[model samples]
Target: MSAATPCVLVIDDEAQIRKFLDIGLRAEGYEVLLAADGAQGLALAATRSPDLVILDIGLPDREGHDVLSELRQWSHVPVVMLSVRDAESEKVKALDAGANDYVTKPFGIQELMARLRALLRSRPGEPDAPQRYDDGHLMIDLARREVALDGTSLALTRKEYAVIAMLLRHAGRVVTQQQLLRDIWGATHTQDSHYLRIVIGKLRQKLGDDPATPRWLKTEPGVGYRFLTDH
Candidate 1:
């Protein structure tokens, strides 16, 4: 792999897993970095700013979810989670936590590679021209990175703007937590679901969305999140 190739961080406690990822990613023309646990992974993520991260849910030092939460505090690298736990609830939890994608244990290498390519291809480049979308009362201006409700400008933080923008871009579709995390926070934070919740809560409050009967932002209950533009 060339030195300038996109970097990927592999965070897994298992040495064999790390070795496998390093070999596979490098063979596919990516520069790979390895970390044995969540703490080291976070440190490497902050300092190196890899283009993508492949994280394992089980870590020796800290849970993968906790590491993802910490990463969400700053960076937005794409994160793909690998876990042996195949329960639907577990998948949902990982997705909700902000993972871009999840692969159950004993996954095929080809499938993982394909998913990685798809993710990288879908990532948007910097906005050169202004982007605006409106379904009547809801308006989003991408160039300005702003959202307005009923012509009233809504105050939002950077992360909040990123989240809502992502949802609006894929309005009416179920955007998994992992996808949201990767799009908004980048690959490294795909496991930070609490961040998603906090930001979504702020958005709901700003838009006057009733948590009891949300019209715009809808929850998928054990899946991910969806933006209901029809509302």
Candidate 2:
């Protein structure tokens, strides 16, 4: 299989459910991994690093919520909780606990597949950004290292491009100040928030973004920055 193939780990205690999902997921072109209980699931998650996890809420050893909480401590891999209970509260609890989506038992395979595709498209664990991003006014061609705004190329310094590119790659999520600093300027400069602020300011100005009513960059205030794909 190609490296781009998405691997999905299903952690369900039901033998029939596991087999059902294994066949269904494989038929949908997803590489599937199976775990009978929470412990084995957690182990596979840590070792195999599958792109997504389909976890049963009721496991033999422990509740799936506990497993999800433990997994969230380290990994951001997308999780879709499986349960026989279709209660709204149960769904809310799973989502609050960090499950990306929830599927009740006896679900249509096509519906489940659709949800999986949507989650993977917006998955935080995606390894790379799309080659280009164009939001009407701004155009970024990452492969060519080019940035254009309003039909004209704008001159951006190395640091400026790096900051915007990093933000674009993780669009719709907060990229912490320390993360940007460490990735762009190195570990020693992680404490230097000013450098990040300056670069962000420059990029915003060139892109005609206002920090107060930002169209592209949004400040998380003392935490980090998020690139706004919607705005």
Which residue pairs clash in candidate 2?
none
Model 2, 1-231: lDDT tens digits are 134799999999999999999999998888999999999998777655688999999998999999999888656889999999999999999999999999998899899999999998887645667678898899998999999998899999999999999988888766778778888998789789899989998888898898999988999765578888885
TM-scores for every candidate against the unseen true structure: 0.54, 0.55
Candidate 2 lowest-lDDT run of ten: 122-131
Which residues of candidate 2, in runs, are more than 4 Å off?
A: 1-3, 125-231
Best by lDDT: 2
Write model 1 residue lDDT over 97-134, tens digit each, in one string.
Answer: 88889999888878999988887767556334236778
Prediction 1 TM-score vs. true: 0.54
Candidate 1 regions exceeding 4 Å error are 1-4, 125-231
- Candidates in order have lDDT scores of 0.80, 0.88
Instruction: State in Å the error of residue 100, model 2.
Output: 0.4
